[model samples]
Target: MELWPASLAEITPDLYATEEVESEDKEVVAKFFALGSSLTWYVVEAQKLEFGDVLFFGYVHTGDWNSEWGYFTLKELEQQRYLGGIPRIERDLHFEKKRFGELDLEQ
Candidate 1:
């Protein structure tokens, strides 16, 4: 699947655009996850770097105890693969924009 579509890039805010907003109030623009893993990413903002790569910032839930906000890149996600060489990460096409506080992170 195409992970970073033009439609997504149009909706996602540039990096640091939400810096003034409280964490809970930050709007999550998109969602991504590993096809067969518990890992998930809630993207809040993104920016194209000088090298022409997009960098994403948001909440990453690796597990119940390892969720945190940080930066990741398009290249990193594209490079991920499962044991059989299947692409691992995929964007959640059905995701709707919502505030961070509205998420049911407890799952």
Candidate 2:
């Protein structure tokens, strides 16, 4: 994984215990974004990660989850091109060629 190039700090238990805790962290949450966009990109707050916590993130061209262009495992992030999610896009041309390849060679 790229490690997001960000860090998380420890929050005080007392501050997080109050009913207003969520409100207090509103600004902090707003500033936390996994990916940077051309319009709004900045290094903001840090996120506290715990053991066994699943760090699930998807790489998207337009930030559209439904329009998934690819998928990626955390392992792939170490490579430069694999920084973003892997593309699962279906190309009609490629699919057709693949299907053709599956046919009997004699034909």
Candidate 3:
């Protein structure tokens, strides 16, 4: 699907942008083995990130949906993927609320 970020962010001016997240904004990606719904994560070296650190260049979900793009360690992600077995990424990131909605928009 095609997304028009410019229209939404520019019209609102205060919502579209990249911000450095804190510890709570980080996401965890992992590979898991599932047997009929029973899942087990792969914590081996292959699950590690490729770079020392990773930051997602994505937007967060809000307004009834509590979700964020989340940060990760790239080197670790790539390393883990190279392990050879079936591996995937899993992360538990958080969502935030907007506090500037109260501002009056200039028509």
Candidate 4:
């Protein structure tokens, strides 16, 4: 699936847009995950740079003990690959937008 699709752009707030909002109140606009792994990214906002690159801000879940909110770029996600060079990360097509507090973060 296409990450940073136009439809997503329409809904995602610009970078820093939610900085003033409480984490739980922020709206997660999209979800991405690594195939065959538990890693996940819950995008809350994004910004399209002048050079045509997109930067995303979200909560990243790397493991049971390691998860945090941070900024990531589309290029970074695309560059991640499995041993066979297959793209490892993919957008969760079935994901629906929701408040961050509604997420089952324990997963």
RMSD (Å) per prediction:
1.3, 18.4, 14.1, 1.2
lDDT of 3 by residue, 1-91 (tens): 1111222223322212323434243221222222233222211111112443432333233323443343323343334432465334333
lDDT of 1: 0.90
Residue 95, model 3: lDDT of 15
RMSD of 1: 1.3
Q: Scored by Cα lDDT, where does model 3 land? A: 0.28
Q: Against the hidden true structure, what lDDT does model 4 obtain?
A: 0.92
Candidate 2 lDDT over residue span 1-107, tens digit each: 22332222232121223234232232221111223331111111222345422132221233343322122322233232323644322212211111211322221
Which ten-residue region of model 3 has the weakest summed lDDT? Answer: 40-49
Candidate with best lDDT: 4
* lDDT winner between candidates 1 and 3: 1
Local distance difference test scores for all models = 0.90, 0.25, 0.28, 0.92
- Which residues of candidate 2, in runs, are more than 4 Å off? 1-7, 12-16, 21-30, 34-51, 54-107
- Clash pairs of candidate 1? none
Q: Residue by residue across 1-107, what tens digits does model 4's lDDT show? A: 57779999999999999999999999999999999989999999999986778999999999777799999999999999988888999998999999999999777
Off by over 4 Å in 4: none
